[model samples]
Target chain A: MMEQVRVVLDHAGDISPISSEEYLRIGGYQGLKKALEATETIIDTIKASGLRGRGGAGFPTGLKLSFTANTQADQKYIVCNADEGEPGTHKDRIIMVEIPHRLFEGMAIAAVAVGASQGYIYLRAEYPYVATILEQALADARRQGLIGSNIMGSGVDFDIQLFIGAGSYVCGEETALLDSMEGKRGEPRFKPPFPGVQGLWGRPTIINNVETLSNLPAIMVKGPKWFRSMGTERCPGTKLFTLCGNIAHPGVYEFPVGTTIRTLFEEVGGGCPRGKKLMAVQTGGASGNIIPASLLDTPMDIDACAEAGATFGAGDLMFMDEDSCLLDVLENLTEFFEEESCGKCTPCREGNTQLLRLIREFRNGTAQEGDLNLLLELSNVMRGGCLCGLGQSSPNPILSVLRFYPDLFVENSYRKGDLAYA
Target chain B: MTTREEQLCVLEEVAAIAAKWRDRPDMLIPVLHEVQTIAGNCIPKEVAMTVAREMRIPLAQIYSAATFYSFFSLEKRGKVLIRLCRTAPCHVKGTKETLSAFEQALGIKAGETTPDGLFTLEICECIGACDVSPAALVDDTVYGHLTPDKVRELVASLQETEGSR
Candidate 1:
């Protein structure tokens, strides 16, 4: 069946549309106004909506908000996690570029709901233009009385700040993001305190992804039933999939969570770029496993993604067609993890170094018979022992790639040239 | 000692930035970028010390941040700082050719400054001008799609402009 391309864009077909103007026009602040007007309704709405954390873990967003709200602290903070350093994952970048104001409004609304006064968007420095736009939007939001004290005369006060990561991938982990924001190195902190309890200057905080926040307004405005009706029971609402690589049309696709990846590619993204068939689909960016083209009909719903052993992770859907080498993709993603690892824990820091060395060996063809086994073993050690999400998630690519592409291993071995896009 | 006018200039700039973005607190990088573009490449020690006095950000932090990235030039720079790409894509295209051309043109190594201070040459990570294959930045201005002859002429153009100024 043919389907219309869901316009996740701030304003469809408007070239110069600013996210702020377009967002406000599309019943944007109506949610914030509603939240401010009925404080109790905010928590109830999120709980009823069933919106899972799109940042890969799929935790219940309302539950996290409610838990943080219940925590007894002098102050609580809201952080929009935008440190999207994953290779194929440019999804968060789209949200930041198109509707930063919407994210801000969502944060402000969430902040008020949780009795918090301030929010932070920890964006990576790779998004220089997004950073500039966010700064501009923030200033405008402040001037409009949507952010500052007594917003809209509802007496709900809130403000937002942005911090840029030096392109560290691990900072996407909620706790690590909290640490980096506190003026320390961009390494992941231990999580018994959990950002929800002791975050940002040892205060309670709620860290939600940019996409997760964008959904807040919709959930609040249209009600949870409308959101739930789109996706499955556990997974609700239309997700924005940042489609890229050898596909015929490489861009973001906003569709219901349960939409099969094939339908998304065939109908929404206009089928694989050129006539090339799909080789693999990488959901959840670099951390998630790569599904082979044989599984093109695999539904991209949260349950299916989990059964396929990948998380939604900021919803970065990377499609690779035939004629592309998995070894090269692994190498590209590896190089990113190596450079972006914060080096706080031994497993992630040293394990990543060892993994890269081994991956390089496989590419160099200097790999021994047990080289794959050894890589798998190292991944196991890193996955279980790492301090934070950075080290733990590092094994995902190594583990997933070896399982899917055994032929790419034996033929190419290890070679530096394989990493390049030929 | 730095003059009072210099002190007041740093004071007003820091104060203005603090007043504007004190809430955001994350605009510090862009703020510091504009500050360093003033006469010297870095926030001079005196200026750093002054910002420290007003904003409570330490002089050490200011120096540490300025030194962390290659973009923030700490020491006095030559009129032209020729930072060429040294990463994989550029290296694959033979950045050595560019290095050799600069060596012959300036009679100095890639990291050395000419005795006359007209040019300072160095290798850098990718500056995102991969379209140029071998590219360079001269004083924050990008020169893409460069070759050996272009490097030589680029130096010549710089010398000509310096003379005119």
Candidate 2:
């Protein structure tokens, strides 16, 4: 019985999320106060806590802040990636509705740590509701001397503004997010001039996930060792997982990083509604790999999930029942990739379209046996040649499903032209 | 209102929006958002042209930015835009049934507006509410864990609100 170790979600349901007074009653901004006392060691303290970015890519939070800190820029910016567009991942909205001040506090502290004066929260436009909540919370924080100049009389002048995304999933990518923030067509820029080097108006920027930012209050308040004790060595701290789909309890749940998928499905998620046997699980979003029931014992850590052939992207564990068809799931994922390709790179744009066509052909029983090999080759090409993570990781669902369930694809391949080829 | 008068009003609002973000080329999205917010439902051609002129951005760039995101609509939409989640999780858990319910209730298919111009139905991708499978967005309000019956009730409630108005 692994009880949920609530860290990021500490104040989620306990108080009125918009009220700064309620947040202060529960020890909010204490971390920022403590952080301002020794601003010099804030990044080092985060590094010592072993806090990794809760965003898809598990970059070290400390290292990202330090990069922006070291860069000699007159105007630096910190961005909180709230474009929660990844399918099956919705935990950030809970944070937005439950504890928006935590997000503001985290950004304010990051601003102090990295010497940034301005910050932006790039939120998804679909969640216009949460945007209102965040606005209210920002006002509440500002009124209480938490957001504006000389915050709590600490002489740190950091202000944050909310920017709603126009609805591109590619903007969830760090560089693409910066591009979207700049009012450009959201497209991924080439790396080496990473966001930390020359991001957001060609100034050094530190972009972190919404959940990643929310962790700072807890980590800063409690010492590094307290934060490190809960989760595994590499990925310390509890993770917020949006556990949904065909489960008795389909909601946000916080668990230590090393919790097994089996435990999550069986205990927390209640093992599929009405005791239906678990067929498959899509760990992470549509871009995440489809994990078979046999791999349920794998730890939910970033490295462990990668070893199990699924990157723990944004902590979305979508469980499916035995009655659900894998072909239908793959079709949905492929169509999503096709629609969200951004049309920037040829491999992703064309590869995702071709992949969707092949999946549809297979589903319609009009495929050849060679299409599987074609899908594999195309997946490899998209993975290698795509410009951004959107195109690069678009083929993950198809590849992972094919790896785990080859028979499903082969059985579905028996069509009108397949017998002629056979 | 006359078409020319409506166009003039849209231009006036667009100018105000552009002036707010003046000299900040990066604030185009927010400006476009505000323009749409003021204009309601869609960014008119006249408004977009005015934005282009005021912000010194090209018309092609403005159109591309508007068309890029699903939220920014160039064409007119109904007063209440209904975004239904048709992704895998929602699909498996009766999203098609919910869609059918909306179609039956509204007498229009997905992506089509009702004859009265009160509601528009559009299928959106997963909105991160898969936990509450079969979710929908009724003009920024998320309704999750829905069945066909709930969909009908939702439609009825909206109709009631519209009737009262």
Candidate 3:
């Protein structure tokens, strides 16, 4: 039996039982209703759950709310980063479209707990379906009195709005997302006066990942311990992994945090398709580095992945089978960064573009010896110098590919005698 | 597979959504979604501009909203739009090869709609149906485990099926 809980998409979607009542029947806002009564206890529950931010850096969700709760800002904003901009990640969008209402419930309760009146879902342009789902959910929430002034008549007023983002991958960064929400280009703004301190219209804004927001109501009802009881110590609850690549099963997978990477491959995904060997896995979209085959036994727990030099950013797992060339794979990711770079910073704009050219030249077997060294040097520069992750983590793919499979980068190209990742 | 009349009906439906929430500047997101679903894709400057005038919102604001969301298409798509997943997961499953095959069969490149208004080839990021490696969505139907051979068969069947319809 599939133990699936579509909290957001309670009754499927627009074609069927697409109403709050239908959602309610399936135990939907029971969490929110429970949350209103247990307002003060919400953060502790989340902290006990050991739930961490799914969007890149795995910061504890409970700690984020705790910081906001203690902050002296007169106005706090509950911002949901729904911009599912990660190349391989689509779990958030799936959850959003399937059940926008659940996310709204999560957002609303979060607003009440954090004492925020305004909420925004900052979605990316790629996911047009989400905007519709979210809009409909907000309407439903308003009509049901789950949103708007005094939600559920609990005297907690919150207005959730949808804010669309331009095609800038950097906006996935919390600060940059805030900047974009402020009617500016989606560029990464520096930290210090972080969004938790000064965000949106310069108030204390707690930007939560869509998945983070989606998980809120559950934490409220279940208690932090109930949530914590599911996963490993320190990394509790379920982390939704958007599995892609040459795997047999490629879709959104919800599993306990410490599930081994091998289990995700052999069991959940049914292993690599076409009998191909799993060479390396790119965990957490582009920012996360490739976990080599030697590390396939590595568990996907937050700290576990982080210890291996990969932040499980939004849990986007991309599996690269043996047959695919590593150089092309690295170049492919670089081109996306180049196309979606936003060009606000010099290192990313110029460096990523040049990186693409250099990679192409190297692939074409025309790379000078110095060019290889130059590529390495340029990657380091782009990583440190760029204002955002698009540029900062740009070298991850190259470095991972280079370290794990140096043979993929022969004197140039795949060597004539090289075996096909046997 | 809608008639021009049905298409126009969708526009009317969109217009109604726009009219209903004209007072709330916040209703822009919903209004756009309904309109886009009706319009097939959001194109024609007039669609947004008309909303701007009727809703009394700035054109800049409408355009900004339209451009920000990925669903709003600014131009006409071919009758059958074939967007293959090109993101990391899809890439792992040889999306490049699938795209190459699509371009090969269509005699066109990425983002190009065929001359007869039949097929448009695009490389979209992982459509999030990663449970099926190397997926391609033809309008709403998702095709997984795509190969160069599958591409040829799909293009052939789509054209034939369109003719029969």
Candidate 4:
């Protein structure tokens, strides 16, 4: 019987998200207050907490903050990646709609730690109503002098503005997000002078995801040791997992990292509905791996899932029942990648279209035996040569399905020369 | 097509919106969003030109952003644009049926606008309303937990509001 351990979502539904007074009543800006009091030690405290980015990458949050902090720059900025564009993931929407002040407080703490005087919340255009809610929350925080100049009577001045993205999925990648914020096409940029060193307007900018920033207020108020007390050694603190697809319970659930897939499926999600047998599960969003039901006991931590040849990307668990077809699922995911590829690099731009065509052939039962080898070759090229995460992980669903259920391909395909390649 | 005078009115409105953002090049997307809202859900050629000139941004950059994003439209749309979720969760939960229901109710297929200028049907990647699977966004509002009956009823209600208008 696994249950939700509410850390970031504390007082979620009970508090008025638009009212800073209610947030204060529940100890909202205490973390920002603590952060303002001890500005020099904030980065060290965050490092000790072992908090990682919740936006699928699992990068350490403290290290990212310290990079921008350590860099010498006249103008530093903190950008919150509220562009929650991942398929089957809606936890950030809930967090922003329920506990927006907590998110703002987290950003203020990060700004104080990194010496950034300005911040931006790059909200997605899909969630326009969520933007209105955040606007109200931001207004309330400003009214209390919590976000603007001289927060809590301290000399630290930091304020956040909302910038809405139109409808580009690639903008969820941090570099593309920065490019989009600059009012350009949402295409990713080359790294090495990463956003930590050279970001928005070529200034040192620290971009943290909505979920990652939402954890800061709690960590600062509760101390680093208390934050590290839960979860695994490498992956500390709770994670928000959104379960959907053929499951009885399909909503956001918060649990400590390292919770097994079996517990999330059976005990927490109540497994597939109507006594249907679970055939396969896709952990992470559209780019996540598709594993068979036999591997349900794998822990949902970053290191554990990576060790199991999967990723804990954005913590989205999508289940499929016996009635579902593996090839159809692969087609849907492949089509998504093809549509979302920014076309900046050749591998991602052309590779996704070819992959989609290949998957459709499999779905139509017209795929030849050699098409499997072609599919693998294309996926390898895309994974190895794509510019950003979108193209790199686009082949995950195909590869994972081939790994777990190779019998599906063999059973469904035709002999070579029986069907011509389209 | 709008007359030259009507185009001038739209250009003036766009210039005002661009000025509201201080004509900052970085505020191009926001300015275009407002212009799209005012110009009937799409950025017209004249309006884009006006934005480019007022915002001091290149026309290519404006078009790059407008076409890069799914929300921005180059052609005119209906008064109401229905963006249905076409992602995996919605697909697994029968969004196809809901989509067909919408197409049937509206007498137009996906990506087609009704002749009456009331509704436009299109598919979007995801709007993060998977919990209520089979969701569609009308304007800025999200309507989820949809069946064929719900889809028809929603269309009827929208048509009624338009008829009264």
Candidate chain B TM-scores, in order: 0.77, 0.92, 0.82, 0.94
For residues A1-422, what per-residue lDDT tens digits would candidate 1 score against the true structure? 35533423445344322445556777668888888889988988999999888777788999999989898888899999887655555566666666677788789778988899888888765455677878887887777777878886887778888776543456677776775565434556777878888888789999988878878877778899888888888888778776655555656657788888778778767766568777777767667777787777777777887787655665666676676666666765666567666667878888888888888877676776677777888899988998877678877866777677766676675343343221
Candidate achieving the largest DockQ: 4
The Cα error of candidate 4 at residue A93, in Å, is 0.4
Error of 1 at A183 (Å): 1.8
DockQ of every candidate: 0.13, 0.77, 0.27, 0.86
Model 4, B34-148: lDDT tens per residue? 9998888899888888888877888998899999999999998998999999999989988889999999999999999999877889999989998888899998999998899
lDDT of 2 by residue, A1-422 (tens): 35677888886888999999999999999989988899998999999999999988999999988998999989999999999888888899999989898989899889999899899999998888898999998988888899988899988888889999887789998888998988889989989899898999999999999999999998899989999898899999999988877888888889999888888888888888787998899988888999898899988899999998976888888888999988888898888878888898888889899999988978877877577788889899999999999888888988888889877777765533455323
lDDT order, best first, reads 4, 2, 3, 1
lDDT of 1 by residue, B5-80 (tens): 8767766775666445443434445556556655345566655665455556666765655554345555655657
Per-residue accuracy of model 4 over A1-422 as CA lDDT, tens digit each: 47589998999999999999999999989998888888998999999999999999989999999999999999999999999988999999999999999999999999999899999999999999999999999998899999888888998889999999999899999999999998999999998889999999999999999999999999999999998888889989999999988899899999999999999999999989999999989999999999889889999999999888666999999999999988888888888888989989999999999999988877777886589889999999988999999999999999998898877776665433234443
C-alpha displacement of A324 in model 3, angstroms?
A: 1.9
Q: Rate the local accuracy (lDDT) of all candidates.
A: 0.70, 0.87, 0.75, 0.91
Give the DockQ-based CAPRI class for model 2. medium
RMSD of each: 6.6, 1.6, 5.4, 1.8
Off by over 4 Å in 1: A1-22, A407-422, B1-165
lDDT-best of 1 and 3: 3
Residue runs of model 2 more than 4 Å from their true location after superposition: A415-417, A420-422, B1-3
Sort the predicted structures by TM-score, highest score first: 4, 2, 3, 1
Model 2 DockQ (Cα-based)? 0.77
Error of 3 at B113 (Å): 3.2
